[model samples]
Target: MSLGTVSQAGLLLALVAAATLSGCGQQTLDNSQDVAAALATGGGSSSPQATERELPTFDCNALGERASSIEMLICQEPELAKLDQQLAEVYAKAGDKAVNEQPPLLKAEQRGWIKGRNECWKSEDKLQCTRDSYQRRIVELQARYHLVASTGPVFFACDGNPANELVTTFFETEPATMIAERGDRSILMFSVPSGSGAKYQGGDYSFWEHQGEARVTWGYGAEEMLCKPTTQDDK
Candidate 1:
């Protein structure tokens, strides 16, 4: 996640451009990967030497004379470039699973996500911000699209009421994640460092599990509910 020093001024401008593009609702180009591959291949040469050189999934050269600050960073940083490639592969798999859906939900969401990732320049720790942005997005796509192995639709009765239950499925993502569904609502939470037990938080929900019990708060400012796993296998 560590990136070398970069100019803050450049990043600020990049953030502005990213936000503007996002607001304008830019559509993702379908042939972007092809274009990138061509660039990596040195004008479609595709020699073994050219293929040996690792490049970002997107066209770093396509940025042309005046590249965005974020783009420049990704091009220069191997770690970031590797992450970009990983995300591209995962995204492609997810897209295949979601191909039948109307309106192409995955494509639209990916466009928005790219904008959000570019906006990471606003953070004081810009490198960490960018890295976290990629990691979280990868975990999200994996969980949402079920691209990884998973465990449990484990049920938990909350507040001593069997009817008031939470159903959770854990995914084997990098940071580990769980989707908790109650009624018609579902929240995807990522694991966080905890002193005593596993803790996950996302959106308006927070869940902590210790032993066979859990404490959960489903919404902002809501009372925490004590829960016990009702499923023996999960316990």
Candidate 2:
């Protein structure tokens, strides 16, 4: 992995710490208090209903004669249209789960996300950006709602640091969630794909895999980490 100047160990540590902090109050764990405090809040809406709610469906046909530029572009492109259909299908399943649970907060977030997605029309790569936004959001909902099955826990030992590792355990939560643990510390990570590889994000950190290497970042203040896979016991 060509990570340039980033410290792979620090990046892995930051990612694990951030994930642990996000899952703090949501579940009980035998971890440190410092980590607990860090997990108390997350990068989600300030709605109690954030954890449960109906996923929103986007309709290109429903727009009829009055479609936004983004919608029009999506409908005009075959690939984009396919993505839109896929997103709608997943939204339907997630919405069913949300209606039974009645999570008003999630509904609100969907609306906000739609607005942000539409704003991508102003970007240089409008079509690609819009398509990516849909794909990422679909991954988030599918993972959050447990609409799809998770393969199970995956471990990656950081390069140059035999003692550092990342472990992810998937769960069937109201909004599908995962616990990422490294040693006695753990954090929450939500599903968000980065290309064909799985990418999880929480708080100030994110973990992604590309071309068989794990790329991670702790926050805006830290450099990214690229590490190779090794035996879980290698840590």
Candidate 3:
């Protein structure tokens, strides 16, 4: 072959090699674009799973057009919604314990409680009332069901008479709580700020304990009873 012909053949082979590289580069560019598009659209199986978010116990969006003001308020307020979720969880646990009971007491009580909660609208500060209602109910269910740890059935002899006695049990609830029982009567009280000792107040009842002695009043306008802790031997 002539030198020119040989040179022409070599140039053709080089040109073919360049075309092949160009095609490969175009394919690589397309593949890179595909990966980017998949990432941007969150489309590929290899993409990380989305972080899950918590939702309220009830469907906030399903409140519908005729939903009550209180219902709407609960749905709108994150704190109230969270409280509702907490209450539902606590109530479910209580219900599970009461499942074997004859009357389904927990279920009935929950229905009544819901009615009472709705009555918060009558108060001047509905939000505060509702919040208080939820907190109290949660604490009550927790204590009543033994869902939380408690510190006593500690006995207190009122006015130095063992016959006139009050039974007290303190529970580890949010803000803490105590149930004071005298005869058939029981009052649930919440912890309050006190300059000295520990104090709890609920409705018309107030109990204050310092050292081993307690001053308790059971009724409205009732005289305070100075009580001392008693053991089984004292009873």
Best by lDDT: 3
lDDT at 56, model 3: 52
Query: Tens digits of per-residue lDDT for model 1 on 43-143?
Result: 76533224434478777758987666677777777677778888998999999899888777898899999888888777887778888989999999999
What RMSD does each model have against the real structure? 21.7, 30.8, 8.4
Q: Which stretches in model 2 have alpha-carbon errors above 4 Å?
A: 1-66, 100-103, 151-167, 170-203, 207-235
lDDT of 3 by residue, 77-177 (tens): 66677788899899989888887877667878888998888888788988898899899999999987789999999998999898998999999999899
Question: Deviation in angstroms for 13 in model 3?
Answer: 22
Candidates sorted by TM-score, best first: 1, 3, 2
How do all the candidates rank in terms of lDDT, highest first?
3, 1, 2
lDDT of candidate 3 at residue 145, scale 0 to 100:
79
**What are the lDDT scores of the predictions, listed in order?**
0.85, 0.69, 0.85
Model 3: ten consecutive residues of lowest lDDT:
46-55
> Least lDDT summed over 10 consecutive residues: which range in candidate 1?
45-54
User: What is the RMSD, in Å, between candidate 1 and the native fold over all Cα?
Assistant: 21.7
Q: Could you tell which candidate, 2 or 3, scores higher by lDDT?
A: 3
- Backbone collision count in every prediction? 0, 7, 0
